[model samples]
Target: MKNSLKLVLAVVLCVFLAGVAGFADEYILGIGFTIFMYIALAQSWVVLSGLTGYISLGHVVFFGSGAYVFILIWGLVPVWLGVFCSGIVVGLVSLIVGYPVLRVRGPYFVILSFGLAELVKNLVLINEARMYVSMRPVFGAPALYQLYTAMLLLAIIATGLTYWIRRSRFGAGLRSIREDEEAAETIGVPVAKLKLLAFAISGVIPAMVGAIFIMRSGIFQSGDAFTPIVSFTMVTMAIIGGSDDAPGPFLGVVFLVLLQELLWVNWPEVYMIILGILLLGFVLFIPNGIYGWLSEKYFGNKKNVT
Candidate 1:
C-alpha cells in the first residue's frame, strides 16, 4: 500500500511538473495537450483491458459520442456540463451495449469490439452526423486557451481517478478477475456487476477526452472518432508501456507520442507497421510490459512466482 501511494504521488508530481513546464513554453504547450489526451486514452484502456482482461476495441464509440455532444452542446450549455453529460451518456450506452457483448471471450470479443468502431463510424457518415450540430468555431486564439485549460484539468482528474480505482476494493476485485475469472466468481466477486462498472468507468474517460479534443481541434468528424487505428494505438500504448501498472499508461503515452511526432508525418504506413512489430515484441519478449519488465528486473516480482 505504501509503495502504491508512493507510485501514485510520483505520477502526480511528474504530471504536475510537466504541466507547469508546458505552461512555460509556447510550442511545447500545444504538444502538452496532445500528450494529456493520450494519457487519458491509455489509462482508460488499461482500466478495462489491463485490469479486467477484456480487450475492448471500440473505445472510440464512447469517445466519438462525447465529441459529438460537446460539439452540439458546448455553446448552448456550460462546457463543463457538456463534458460531464457526454461522458454519462456514453458510459450508460456502453453499459447497455456491453451487457451481452461482455459475455464472450478471447478473439471473438476482440473482433466484436473492433467491429463496433466501424459500425459507429459508418452510422455517423451516412447520417450526416454533426459532431457539433451548432458548433461555430471561436474567431481566434483566446478560444484555444480556454480549451487547453479544460483539457488539462480533465487529464489531471482522470489520472487521479485511475489512482483511486487502483486502490479501491473494486480495483482489487478486477485484479482477481484478471487473474482467474472462474475462481474470482466462486470466491464472491460479482463478476458481471464489477465488469459492467469497469466498462462504464472506462467508457467515461474516453468521452471526456473526446470532448476536449473536439473543442480544441475544432474538427469533430466521425471518421476521426471511430477510427480503428485510435483503439489499436491506445491498446498498443497500454500493452507496450506496462499494462499491469498505472505508470505504464503514462510511460506508454510519452513513448508513443514522441514516436508519432518524430516518424508519423515522414512515414505514415511504416509507422503503423513498426507499431505492430513493437506490439508483437512486447507480447513475446516483455509480457509484463515495459513497466512490468522493469519491476521484475529492478524491484523483483514480490507478488509471488505465479
Candidate 2:
C-alpha cells in the first residue's frame, strides 16, 4: 500500500512538474498535452493487451463511441461534464461489446475487435446526423487551452487509476489469466468478469481521450476520433516502449511522439513505415522492448549477481 501510494504521488508530481515547466513555451506546452494524450491511450491499451493479453486491434471503437457521445451531449451540457459521462458510456458500451467478442481468443479475438471498430465507423457514417455536430447547432464552447488542461487532468487521473489497478488484486487476476486462461479458470480467477472489467476500464480512457481530441482539434468528424492510425499508433507505442510494464508506455510515447514530429516535416510515411518495421524487429530481437533491453543489459545483470 505504501509503495502504491508513493507511485501515485510520484506520477502526480511528475505530471504537475512537467506541465509547469512547459507553461513558458507554447510549442513545448502543446507537446506536453500530446504526450499525455498518447500516454493515456497507450496505457489504456496496456490494461487490455498487456495485463489481459487480449491484443484488441480495433480499440478505436471505444474511443470513437466516446467522442460521439460527447458530441451528442456537448450542446446540452458543459464539455468537461460531457467528457466525464462519455467515459462511463464508453465503459458500458465496451462491456456490452465484450460479452460476445471476448469469448474468442488469439487471432479471432483480434479480428472481432477490428470488426467492432469497423462497425463503429460505419455506424458513425450512417448515423452522422444523430452522432455528430451537424445534428445540433454549435454554441459557445470552452477555449482550446482550457479544454487541453481538462484533457491533461483526465489523462493524469486515468494514469493514476491504471497504476492503482496494476498493483491491486484485480491486477493479479489479470496477470494470471494472461499467463494461462485455462489455468486461471481452474484456479477460480473468474476469467470472464476480470476480462470484462479490464475491457471496460480500457474503453473509458480512449473515449475520454476522444472527447478531448475532438474539442481541442476542432474536428467533430468521427474519422478524427476513430482513426485506425490512432489505434495502431497507441498499440505500437506501447509495444515499442514496453506495454508489459508502466514505464514502457511513457517511454514509448515520448520517443515515438518525438519521432512523429520529426517525420511530420519530412516523409511522414517513412516515419510510420519505419516505426512499424522497428516494432516488428523489436518483437523479434528485443522481446522486452527498449526498456527491457536496457534493463537486462544493466540492472538485470546486477539483480542476477545480487
Candidate 3:
C-alpha cells in the first residue's frame, strides 16, 4: 500500500517535470535542472556512503572526471553518446580504485576520500596548464528543455535504483557492513565485492550529471569541474534529506534548491554561509534528517533505510 502511493506520486512528478518546460521560462527550467541534478547526486551518495557508512567526502571527483571526459571527446560523438561514455568511464575508474579505496574504514576513509579528490583536482589543473588550455568551451549545445529532460530522467533512474537496492538482499548486506563489517564478513556477507559494486554504481550518474551540467555553463574549467562546493552540496543535501531512503533526496533537494534560487542571485556568498550554518545545525540536531524525523512522527519508527 505504501509503495503504491509512492509510485503514484512518482508518476505525478514525472508528468509535471516532463510538461513544465512547455510553458515555463528558462529560469524555471534552470531551477528544475539544478534540483534534478542534485537529486541524482544525493541519491548516488546514498547508494554508497549512506548504506555502507563509508562517508565519502570526495564524491565530486566522479562528477568532475566524467565531465572532463565528455568535454575531451566533445564533437567527436553524438551528445547523448558522450553523456553515456562519461558515465561508463567514471564507473570503470571507480571499479579500478574501489578495492584499495574501500579498504580504509572510519575517519581514515573520510580523509582519504577528501585527499584523493583534492589530488585529482590539482592534477587536472596542472594538466590543463600544460596543455595551454584554460577552459573548454561547449559549442552546439542542446536546448535547455532537452538537457532538463535528460537530468530529470537520470534523477528518476537513480531514485528507482536506490529504492530497489534498499529493499534487496544486497541492501541488507550493505547495512550489515555499516553496522559491523567484520561480523558481516564472518557471516559470508561478501563485504568487499558489495562495497566495490556500490561505489562504482554510485559514481556513474554523477558523472553523467557533470556531462550534462557543463552544457549549462557552455564552458568547463578544471576548477569548476572539480570544485569542492559540488561535493559539499551533495553531502549537505543527503544529510538534510536523510540518505537512508530514496525519498529523502527529493525532500532535501527541493527545500534547499528553492532556498538557493531565492538567495543565490542577490548574494551568492551569503548562500554559502547559510549552507554552512544549516550543515552544522542539521548535523548537531536533526542528524537523521527530514525523512527520518517525519517517518518517526507518522509511520511509526524511524527505520534506518541506509
Per-candidate TM-scores read 0.86, 0.88, 0.96
Model 2 lDDT per residue over 1-306, tens place: 377798788778776745665354657657777888888888888888988889988888878888889887887876678888999998987788889889999889888888889888877877885544443333566664565576567667666766667778898899888889999999899999999989999999889888877766666776666778888888888888876667678788889889888887788768768777888898898766666666678765421121
- Give a tens-digit lDDT track for model 3, residues 78-127: 99999999999999999998989999999999999988888998999999
lDDT of 2: 0.79
Off by over 4 Å in 1: 1-26, 129-142, 264-270, 302-306
Clashing pairs in 1: 71-132
lDDT scores of the candidates, listed in order: 0.77, 0.79, 0.92
Please give the RMSD to the true structure for each candidate, in Å.
Answer: 3.4, 3.5, 1.6
Q: Give the TM-score comparing model 2 with the true structure, all chains together.
A: 0.88
Compared with the true structure, the alpha-carbon lDDT of candidate 1 equals 0.77
**10 residues in a row with least lDDT, candidate 2:** 297-306
Q: Which ten residues in a row have the lowest lDDT in candidate 3?
A: 297-306
